[model samples]
Every structure is written in C-alpha cells, then in structure tokens.
Target: MFGIKFFLLVTLPFVLRFILAFSTFAPVAAWPVWSGIKPRNSRLATVAEFFNLKDRKMAVDASVWVRAMHGDKSAFKILSERCESDVRLTEKIYWKLLPFVSRLERYGA
Candidate 1:
C-alpha cells in the first residue's frame, strides 16, 4: 500500500489503474490480452510459471514487477540493486509506460 498527503492529511491510496497486458490463461491462447484495450491478465502468476518453464530473464523481471504491484515499496530499490547485472532501466520503463499510453490513445487528452 502507498499513501499521499493532501492538505496535511495522510490518505492511503490504492493503485486505481493497473494493467496486466498478457497471459497464458486467456481464452484465446494466441492473442495478446484477448485483443482488448486494457485487460488484466494473470501476468505475475504467468511469469512465476515461466520461471518453472526455464525463461529466466522474463521471470526475473516479472518477479520484481510482482513485488512492486503487491505493495512492496522497496521493490524498485531491489531492482536498482540489480541494475548492471540483471535489469535495464529503459526497458523496464518502456514496458511500464505502455499501459498508460494505451489508455491515452483510447481516451482523449
């Protein structure tokens, strides 16, 4: 969970917008996000499963993403710790920004 202060009042803020872009459990096995605009897939769970399937790189990134989504405020710090070795900031940011960009395109400015 996270909080934001407004007018000196502390308010716990839940993430109101989150999108899991793709999953293996979707009805259409060959499509991304069931061809919907912004559907929530079982992405973290799928990634966890990927680890078992030997996709190390995607699994590692998804593990960090799962932690962050599940209220681990230090998840980003953990990712930074793996900077040069396991993760690239640009790639992570690009993936993270995708959902927001999609929303912008579907909606208006």
Candidate 2:
C-alpha cells in the first residue's frame, strides 16, 4: 500500500505534466496557418512558371546564360553554342531592321 502510494505520487505528476506539455504544443504541431498564403506580385508567378518541368529546356538555357554572364566561361561557352543558331537568326533580323529604320528616318526627315 505504501509502495502503491509512492508510485502514484511519483508517476502521476510526470504523466500529467507530459500530457499538459503535449497539449500545449499541439496547436503549434498542427499545419501552419500561413502555408496557404501566396504572393500578390506577378514576378513571383513568373518565377513559379520558370520552375515548371514543362519549361525545363528553356530554364536550363537561361540558367546557363546567366551563369556565363556571371563569369563562368565554361557555362557561357555551353550556353552560347547551344543558342548559337537562334542567336544568329535574331541578329540577322535585328540587322535587317536597322536599314529599314534608317530608311524610315530619312523619309521622315
């Protein structure tokens, strides 16, 4: 009977304290309330779009160019070679526009 009383005195407080501690932390352990919040800016949306798997190829190309521009020669070389054909095409179109713009300016003058 004395051992039983001693056990209750020692273990009961610990068990109650444990339960209280867990209950106190229960709300914190539950899902975060801020998890559903999203940014109102379109830039965040664009970043999410850039991370999509469907845009992996473009993302890789853009990342390479960004790395190269940041002084990574190897990355730049890889990006430049990968985009060389498209870059040249764009340059051609841009150069062609220059002469037409000059002609327009001369006519306007």
Candidate 3:
C-alpha cells in the first residue's frame, strides 16, 4: 500500500503535466482578468499567452486575441480576414472571443 501511494505521488503530477503540455485542444473560451490596480500599471496588461494550435484558423484567432489584449486593434482585422477565408472560422472565433468582444463594445473601443 505504501509503495502504491509513493508511486502515485511521484508519477501523477508528471502524467497530468504531460497531458496538458501536449494537448492540442483549445478552451471553449478564455478571458483576460484584471491583474491589479497598482500604480502606473494597466488593468489588463498582464494577460495570458494564447495557445498555439495546429489548425490554421484557430491558431490565427489565438494570435489575434493575444495581440488584442496588448492593445492592438489591428488584430481584429487579421481575425476578420481569416474569417473571410473560411466561414466556419467566424463562428469559432465569435465564441472564443465573446468576452473580449463584449468588453470592447462596452468601452466603445
């Protein structure tokens, strides 16, 4: 019983980490939460890096979101171009960026 516990304790984290590291699946959605209200700091500056995916459209959308989070409005233009190239990408991107889209509309950005 002790040996089984030791094995699981040592190996479980490694197994889970490996699966997450290699997984190609993107989350259904992601959002940039406020990091803090520190002086001289932007509210949404410290955002997570977007995932790199194998699918071209998804990859582009992820990249665009990362850029957008960094205050680059041109990222949306690239996303739109990708959507124009593939109609299906529009639906996928819409869901993926729903939170950010709402924020943009709210702020009139």
Candidate 4:
C-alpha cells in the first residue's frame, strides 16, 4: 500500500505533465491572445517559426491589415504570399484582405 501511494504521488504527476506539456497542432484561431502572451523559450514560438510567419502571424497580420486597408500594393502582395505560400495560413486571411483589391486595381498598380 505504501509503495502504491509513493508511485502515485511521485511518478504519476511527472508522467502526465510531460505528456500534456505542449501541443504540436497549429492553432487556427485566437491569434490575439497567443501573440502577446507565452513565456520565453516557449514551443509556441517554435511553431510560428516553422510556419515562417513573423510574430506568430497575428501581430504581423495586424500591421498588414493597416497597410492593406490604405491600398499599399506591397502590403497586398505580402498578404497574398502569406496565404499562398504557407499552408498554415488560412484562406480567411485572404478574404479579409480582398477588400483592398479593388482599390489597387483602380489605381492600376
């Protein structure tokens, strides 16, 4: 009985903690929450880096949103490249950026 109690107290917690320490699957939503938070030396940054999206995507997307809204061509290109080149980036981002496409076309840029 003592051995069973010792194992449960000492070993089980460690095993469970290790197994659920972090997630490998990329998150599809809640960009704002994860963008600013997360401790230093975190796995979340690693996931972001692997996807090649700067600042875990959300922060940079905000910047892209501002520039694209103003009809910046380069920002538009960056927005398209983000959606097309990175499978991790969802089509929703592309749709959000589409509002500026007509302005760009009007300017003939």
Candidate 5:
C-alpha cells in the first residue's frame, strides 16, 4: 500500500514514459491501464488483499501509512500510545506531515 502510491505517482510516470518512448515498436496503452502514464487504480479494500504485511515492521509502517495518509491523528495517536509501552520503534514525527501524505491521496484514483 505504501509503495503503491510512490510507484504510481512517482515511479510509474518516469519508468513507463521511458519504456514507452524507447520501445517505439509498441504503444503504452497496451498495458493494463488506460495508458502507461499512470497506475491502475483500485479500491483500498481490494488492494489490501494483496499487501500482505509480513511482520511488526510491515504492520507498524502500514498502520502509520494508512492512518497518516488519511490524517487520522486519533487512530495514529492511539497506535502511538500503544507503541510507547511495547515496540517503541516508531517515531513521533512519522505521525505528522499530513500535507505530504495528502499528496498521495487520490480519491477515485
């Protein structure tokens, strides 16, 4: 889920554009998306089925990502509080930066 946004909004644009341009024999639209210019958007629920987090690191990161990305500070705070007693691995700053996270939220995208 975390990498999905970066891969879509950041990586895909550059990488796909390069490949499409280089492979002059083929067109970008041949890919699954309307065009290789962007990622194939899907519901969060559907996507969730695929992002199988393996351990505590993945869980914490994904938890922070899903919560922070939505500006759900209440949930993040609750999670953070729980972390103080047990994990202590996640930092406070990771819960901030709503503005940065907002960029990744493409509703209906």
Candidate 6:
C-alpha cells in the first residue's frame, strides 16, 4: 500500500543512521581511555590555599566578642568598632546595595 511505502521511506534512513551512530560510538563508550587523565589545578585554588590560614586567624579575632559577649566589655567594644567600620566600608564599596540597605532599615532589620 502507499501508506506502507511512505512509512518505510521515512523510517528506513533514520533507523540506519541511528544504528550506524551507535555502532560508531560503541568502542568509545566501552573503553575507559580517560581514566589516567588528571585535571590541572586552578590559580584560584592556589591563591585560596595561601590565604586560608590568615583568613581563619582574622575570623577568630573578629568573632572574639560574639563568642564572649557577656564576659568581656573590651571585647564588645572592639566588636562594635569593627562592625561600624565594616558596615561603612561595605556600603561604600557596594554602592548598588545602598538602596537595599535603606529598605532593610526601613523594615526594622
């Protein structure tokens, strides 16, 4: 029938191409050729490793008051000073967020 002939014409090339593609890729899929390959380290990772120790020290120093808030007034004073400077500098550096901060303050955060 004409319908059967048309169906075969449309499907025969697609089935052949699909089978050929799978056959071509079978060897590539079966072999573990890239198992020995190692990825190169990024420059960012090296820089981060260099500063990681210093970052930890700075974090500990900055949080000294938060960790001992009730026990030490000096620690609290230092924390307040650092927080004021930190907020001012951050706002200056990220001018785009100035509006967002204003909105947050309006909301009483």
Clashes of 5: 0
lDDT of 1 by residue, 42-101 (tens): 354343332233223323568777897887978877765655433443345345435434
lDDT of 1 at 108: 65
RMSD vs true structure, all candidates: 16.0, 24.6, 13.3, 15.1, 14.8, 20.8
User: Ten-residue segment with the worst summed lDDT in candidate 4?
Assistant: 27-36
Per-residue lDDT of model 3, residues 1-109, tens digit only: 4687764555543443333345544333222322111113321111111222223443464767899788787987777776575555434434444432224435554
* Clash count per candidate: 0, 0, 0, 0, 0, 0
Give lDDT tens digits, candidate 5, residues 41-98. 4433222232221223323556776787798987678666655633322222222112
Off by over 4 Å in 4: 1-61, 88-109
All candidates: TM-score: 0.20, 0.23, 0.23, 0.28, 0.24, 0.29
The global C-alpha lDDT for each of the candidates, from Candidate 1 onward, is 0.40, 0.41, 0.42, 0.46, 0.44, 0.39
Question: How many clashes does the backbone of model 2 have?
Answer: 0
Q: Candidate 2's residue-wise lDDT over 27-94, tens digit each?
A: 22122222211223324224233223122122355677778879998997786665764455445434
23-103 per-residue lDDT for model 6 (tens digits): 333222121212211113323333233223222112337468566666677787677776675565444423422222322
Candidates 1 and 3 compared: the better one by lDDT is: 3
Instruction: Give the per-residue Cα lDDT of candidate 2 at 20.
Output: 31
Candidate 5 scores a C-alpha RMSD against the true structure in Å of 14.8
Q: Between prediction 1 and prediction 2, which has the larger lDDT?
A: 2
Best by TM-score: 6
Provide the global lDDT of candidate 4 against the true structure.
0.46
Candidate 6 TM-score, C-alpha based? 0.29
On lDDT, the candidate that comes out on top is 4
Better of 1 and 6 by TM-score: 6
Report the C-alpha lDDT of model 4 over 1-109, residue by residue, as the tens digit.
5697776556654443332234333322322322223323435345455334443443356888799999999999888876554544443333332332333325555
